[model samples]
Target: MSNIVSKSSILILGGSYFIGRKIAEVFEEYGYSVSILNRGTKPLTSLNIEQITCDRNDTECMKKALNDRRFDCVVDVSFKDSSWVENLCDTLDFETVKSFVFISTSAVYDIENLKIPFKENDKLAENKYWTSYGLEKINAEKYYTDYFASMNTRLIILRPPYIYGENNYAKRESLIFKHICESNPIIIPKTNPKLQFIYTDDLAKIINHLFKNNASGTFNVGNKKSMTARDWVNACAKVVDKKVKIIECDYKSLNRNVRDFFPFFDYDNVLDVRKINSIFNEETPIETGLSNAYKWFLDNKSQIAFKENIEKNICEILAKSN
Candidate 1:
């Protein structure tokens, strides 16, 4: 694919989060005029991208930002609710905007039959009940897909599965990281389930490729490989040269932190990336990306601020005990 978007002005919502910041960084690296719209709470000192302060959920604020100025493309990372999606499209519903990229999730797919190589056209559970978060995203995708179907604007939907990397909020990768560093027995669900992980940088690169290629479709982005939860933990321990015990506890015996979503651990939810491969040639491998990510955590473990978070979480747990 030719570099169609050589130097275009880009807007990123939720520009301060893990994946969001990575996307901003990659775009800025490519010489794109990047403007980040967020709450401005998460301070980033090194980024050369322009920062815009606005709560995207507020329709008036969203309209004010793009009132006169128009961007070549807008990547919405914080667009969660249906209202935000509608108002966002209304604000940027223009002829000047070239494309709109939505950072969706693979959670929108049916989890019942999640086998390998889950294609875009694969059958999904249409009548499935979406949770508050999932429903909003489902509706948001429809709004964008249908709205941009007639317009000249290209809509790119990226469904990333289990996004993880250095500085991730989900803390999914932290499970393996913390397990490898410490010697205490790590409690894992007894059931072994296969899941996918996408390093933030890798995901950002794929999104960049789509923008450059003017690709418009739904693409499931993640590491080309999938591994079971047990395998990942064992691999991490091996890499760090740590000897630890994996206590396999049933769902009933799990702690509050472990029991909340323990039922889903047995569900296989590996997202297929064939559509992404067909659209873009480059894809990040799991082993290389995870190795780099593990090294990053080991090098910067002290500066990661997991201690403060742990203290707060412990307090929450204690209060619940009371």
Candidate 2:
């Protein structure tokens, strides 16, 4: 059995949305006292977590919220940069903290992103699509790595590919599932981009995996397999027990932004999980993850916005092209 104390405390930098919410729930289930720090936007519905409502970029607010506080583990699940990292680390009472986990994306390796599977040691560059998002994360990763080395702290950075699961705010799998559920026509590009994905719940479990094992260093956390957009749509269609009408066309060639209709970029984003899987082994297939997501959509579809304006625009573009 693993030797981590389930009762240890943790502080999540952002715990209201998809990834952070799932992680907070998992740690709480493991008996960890969970606390979340974020600008109070959404209320934490399910977990009994302590909330520190303040923007992390506000150095004074962060200091006030985290003064003299300690955590066994701290995970930055928010979209933050090196400045946020510096402010949080400076404000945190690391004297009692053991591990700090930063959620970096596979976008870090985006210059060569479409060509090959990125391992932990891959070269990071600015992604044309993700742009500055990748560069900022690389800087944050560097800062955390350098900062933690001087202390008795385990800094673990996870470079995950496109994450999908229940309550995902991103209009990815859920959007397709909704279209399929509503018997709507779905669009895709001719050169179907293959992408790697990780389940949100599995990622939450992986965070706890590192926290328990005290694992340090960066690791790619995702399923090693890759699936094209059509294959992905077909998988969602299978779960929904609905046949999908997939129209393959180069949206860009039509002078239409692909994102106006499609969810993922026009390139593959695959990650090599051998480093993290060698330790955590928390890969959940899309088939399984989509099943749960479909069930949640059925129960809470009212809560999910289908982006009607974008849908209408996509139809107009496709109709005119036809």
Top candidate on lDDT is 2
lDDT of 1 by residue, 14-75 (tens): 88968889888888877788898888998864557888898877889988987887788889
TM for candidate 1 is 0.84
Backbone clashes per model, in order? 0, 0
Q: Candidate 2: TM-score?
A: 0.94
Return the clash pairs for model 2, or none. Answer: none
Question: How much lDDT does each candidate structure score?
Answer: 0.71, 0.84
lDDT, model 1: 0.71
lDDT value for model 2: 0.84
